[model samples]
Target: MAGGMFIFSAVDTQAKFLTDTLHPFQIVWFRQLGLVLGLVFMLSYHGASILRTAAPGLQVLRGAVAAGSATLFIFAVSYVPLADAVAVTFVAPFMVTLMGALILREPVGMRRWTAVIIGFLATLIIIRPGTGAIHPAAFLVILAAALFAVRQIVSRALAGSDNTMTTVAYTALVSVALLSVPLPFVWQWPTEGWQIALLISMALMAALAETLVIKALELAQAVVVAPLHYTILIWSTFYGWLIFGDLPDLWTWVGAAIITATGIYTLNRERLAARKPPQT
Candidate 1:
């Protein structure tokens, strides 16, 4: 999971780099291109059975949410600082906890609820809504985080019936089909050889990152792997400083620390709860 986060951070950094010349939609489309190719290869090897799903509608919904989350995130990062954008998206775990309680009827204890409140407060520190420091685009990342939360909830629902490969395959197919709709309108062909290479690299990295995440999940329990998601902040911070010379402000770091702390606590609580005997 840590390795996957690092790769994803690289993918985000590359997307930010490409945003200099390409639309966010175009970048997202390109990123999904590699996933489509990978899915095609898997289909050829495993046969069409790989795409089979009992919940096709839910899978489609998950794909749409994934597509929206990816596009919104790319668009947000294009305008906002990488670390700041990433920090805002950290709220997804909190959002997931809340959504699970309300939508999935999963019992959320008081401790997790307190952590959720603190996590959102931490996000506000980065957003600074009333202050002039906030960019209008920062809100886009928050929305993207919400969409990501929905994706997570759907993933939990689908996990009982569908295998990981089917979920990944459907996401790739749906996102590619959705993005391909507007791709032609916003598409700007890469002019330079390096730009072409970077686009291909971004696509390949995106697919690799997804595969790594799936493997990581399979290899470990979700609670055990959850904390590794925080590693992206470190990678994002490093890439932001090294590539873009963008350093997060003290408040951003402070806020991120709070969010990360609360997120770990929340995960730990869930882990503990999962081990408890069910109430009769």
Candidate 2:
């Protein structure tokens, strides 16, 4: 998961760079291109049966949410500092925790709820709403985070009924299809060789990161894997400085620290709960 997060940071950095020349819609389409190719490979290997799903509606919904989330995120990063954009998105796990308890009937105790509340406060600190420290585009990241949480919830629901490949294939197909609608209007052919390279590299990295994250989730509990996302902040900060010569100010760091602390605390609570024997 940590490795995947690192690659994800790289992918975001590359997407931000490409945004200077290409539309977010076009960049995301190319980003999804790698996954579409992987989907083709999966289909060939597993044959048409791989696409079969008991929850077609959920699959389609997840795909649509996935498309929206990816586009929103790419669009957000194009405008805001990458670390700030990513920091705001840290709200996603809190959303997932809340949704899991409320919608999926998963048990969430008071301690986790407290952590979730604190996490929101941390987000407020980063965004500094009335002060307008961050761009309006930051709100788009929040919307993206919400959609991402929905995707995860839908994934959890489908876990029992659908194969992982099926879920991934649907996301790739739906995102590519959705983004294709604007391609003709927004598309700009890469004039330089480096632009072409970055586009392909972004796609390959996205596909690889997707695979690693899926494998990590399969091996560990979501709570255990959740905290690893904070590592992206580290990579984002590094890449933001090294590549873009951008850095989050002191308040952003402070808020990110608080969010990380609360997230780790919440994860610890989950781990303890998982270890406890079932009650009579």
Tens digits of lDDT, candidate 1, 113-216: 99999999999999999786868799999999999888867776777788878988998989999999998899887899988998999999999888777666
lDDT of 2 by residue, 75-156 (tens): 9999899999999988998888888788878799988999999999999999998897988899999999999889867876
- Per-candidate TM equals 0.96, 0.94
- lDDT (CA) per prediction: 0.89, 0.89
How well does model 1 score by local distance difference test?
A: 0.89
Clashes of each: 0, 0
Q: How close is candidate 2 to the true structure, as a TM-score?
A: 0.94
N/CA/C clash count, model 2: 0
